[model samples]
Target chain A: MRAFLIFTVFLAAASAEHCYKEIEKACDPTSNKADSTPINCNAKYGAIDGVQSALQKYVNDHIERSFEYLLMSTHYANYEKSREGFEKLFRGFSDSKWNTAIDLIKYITKRGGQMRFPEIDSEISSNEDYEMYELQSLAKSLDIEKTLAVEAHNIHGLAARRRNEFHDPEISSFIEEKFVHKQADDIRALSGHVADLTKLLDGRDSSLSLYLFDEYLQKL
Target chain B: MKSVVLATVFLTCVVFASAQLQCAQKKPNIPTDWIDMASPCVKKMRGQIQEELKASMQYLAMGAYFSRDTVNRPGFAKMFFQSASEERDHAIKLISYLLMRGELTRDISHMIKKNLVVPKTEWATGVEALKDALNLEATVTKKIRDVIKTCEDPKDSSNFNDYHLVDYLTGDFLEEQYHGQKEIASKISNLDKLMDKHGALGEFLFDKKISGGE
Candidate 1:
């Protein structure tokens, strides 16, 4: 019976040690105090700082592009023979870009990261000819969106790779399922739209093409 | 000995509970990108801020016009100056709103620095200046309405129908804008009638009244 008691005490001590070890592993030293209960900071996940900075820049770029579209709309509105269709189209594009930026900001904040605001250049030069100016603007926007899509893909890839390094299957799957795959599909669709716009601009009359573009954007 | 075992179990439970509580204190996993910074309503608000600043600048110009020795209407000048300050305050409020919502306001600052040209430097008459002021106020009212409309659902499906923004704008701004526009219109009508009935003497007296002189 004495021997049985000694074994029982050893087992209890071992169980307590195991429990304490598990708790210590989860508790973040920076936030957890020795005197108080350990605080878990599992929210700090892979390559967060870098990913956050990139996302912030991406948000800024989207806002800047939105502003550019706004300028384009204003230009079309003010032109001698105002192209209402073009103005409407540009306005739609501006709204779309702005929404995307907001979506990005929302995503970043959801991840427990602070947002950084970027300065935008609002000066846009207007050409004498509305058609040429608008075509150029559309093309410029296409290039910007393409670049943005690539940047987003890269960030997603980085997050995935970091999750792998940390052996964090949950985060890896989350990034893949939530951001990376969806962004890829979105970029592909946007690229197709850009191609369609380019083709339309090349073959059609400026007025009809602009009107069609406005209709197409409205549908989007 | 049985009591000691119960005590150990109780201590274990206590430690676990404390740890769980500490973990629970972690901030809610709010995705930072939840607030759409680029919503149409938000963009309109951003534009409105610039418009407010422009209106303020125009008011300052009107003030300067009235304050001139030849145009000596201290009352009109003082009124314009006050209007200008009020418009500036409106712009600041918009800026604060943008910041609170985590939207960027730096672009407006840049736009103001690079693109803001001076308003009409000289007015032909006090009536003309007041007319412009009325027009400015009207434009601002329309823009505020547009902002409120954008905040409403069905216009932009993506918009969150942010009631707080609607409340802030309609509650504080629209009322003031309406009141200001009405006040300017009244002043213009009164000035016009005084000019018609009393001629140059009426105009002189009106100027004196505006200037706070007997």
Candidate 2:
């Protein structure tokens, strides 16, 4: 019994040491952390040029969208009745985009890539998005959602195809694990809103039904 | 038929014009609110939210400064970035509270463009940055107290004194401010003592003790 307990303790220690080495291997391309067996950080995990640029571009895109949503959220919040609903919707989108961008930023550094985010001008409103009513703005937001979903899908395909040359499956796995489904979820929710709103008004933009819809949206 | 064609053109033009101007609701759209939280109190909260956001942007600037190639102190960079994120979270929490109280908030996202102007990017040293952070925490603490006072107004007819908001700000925001101030102060003093003995090298080594670390 004592021998079995000792064996278990030894196993735990070995596993812990292996985990530490794995993370240590994650950091530097110079030297392996383990004395027992060395792993190449750069050769194993370094993103190819194409993949790195794609990820960087994707991050930049998300950052732009995040700022765009921030503007839209504030624009919606200015209205009288639908303020609560549209504020929650657009602000939630902005938060999600910011989070994904930050995560991708960290992941880029992990893969030994430097980011070059172009300074975005905060003046995003060239169109009349500011004056868009609840249903109209929602329609626009749905379009944004569709674009994001399509982009995520395209990137997933790109990452998968690129993994044939280099062993960097992590990028594909990340998009698959983190983004693809989330984008789908966002699209589903936004599309639902668009359909409901369009049907609620029955092709009319101005109606009492819009106010009624606002109350329902506030609950969400 | 001539009259019908002219009417069709007129109707099309009318639709185009109204599409641009139709955002203005024809009917009254009065918002519903269960809570009696005064607009003054709500406005104060929003103002404080802007203050928190400004501080966040300032911390982000400090983080950027420390991360620069000429002044590469990853420890300080990491610390300031953490503070930036924390300040942002504080603003988010306050905003969430406002939403929960059923108080409507105006579009304050314009503050992003207004508040992100960081005039002094380069500090003399990490020590100077630490002092600035300490001072910032003190100022934010004072602001939080002012918010509490506004919320705790006895003369307001609501008579609830915005007790929940006061309790929340006192408990959560002020606690974080005090703890952060104390930590920054200790870091500054300890570094001062170290620098007196060993100068620049001491400051370098002192920065290595990064609670908000790489």
Q: Could you tell me every candidate's TM-score relative to the true structure?
A: 0.41, 0.57
Tens digits of per-residue lDDT, candidate 2, A1-220, equal 9999999999878755764666565566675546534332232233455576777678767756765676567555543443667777788888887667666755665555545544443444434334466777887788887887788777667767745554356777887888878778877887898778766655335466676677777788
* Chain A TM-score compared with the true chain A, each model in order: 0.58, 0.72
Candidate 1 lDDT, tens digit per residue, B1-214? 9999999999998776544411011222455674564478777887887788678656755665565444556677678767766776687578557656755522332433323344476777777788988898898999898888887652665647878888999999998988878888888998888777676676677777877832
Report per-prediction Cα RMSD to one decimal: 29.5, 12.0
Query: Which one wins on TM-score?
Result: 2
How close to the true structure is residue A82 of candidate 2, measured as C-alpha lDDT?
Answer: 39
Model 1 chain B: worst 10 consecutive residues (lDDT sum):
B19-28
Task: For candidate 1, write residues A1-220 as lDDT tens digits.
Answer: 9999999999878655754654665575655464444332323444565566776677666656665665555455532324466566666766676556545544554454544543333344433222335556555656656676677666666556644333434434655665556556655765675666566555424456656665666566
Which pairs clash in the backbone of model 2? none
Please give the lDDT score at residue A166 for candidate 1.
Answer: 37
Clashes of each: 16, 0
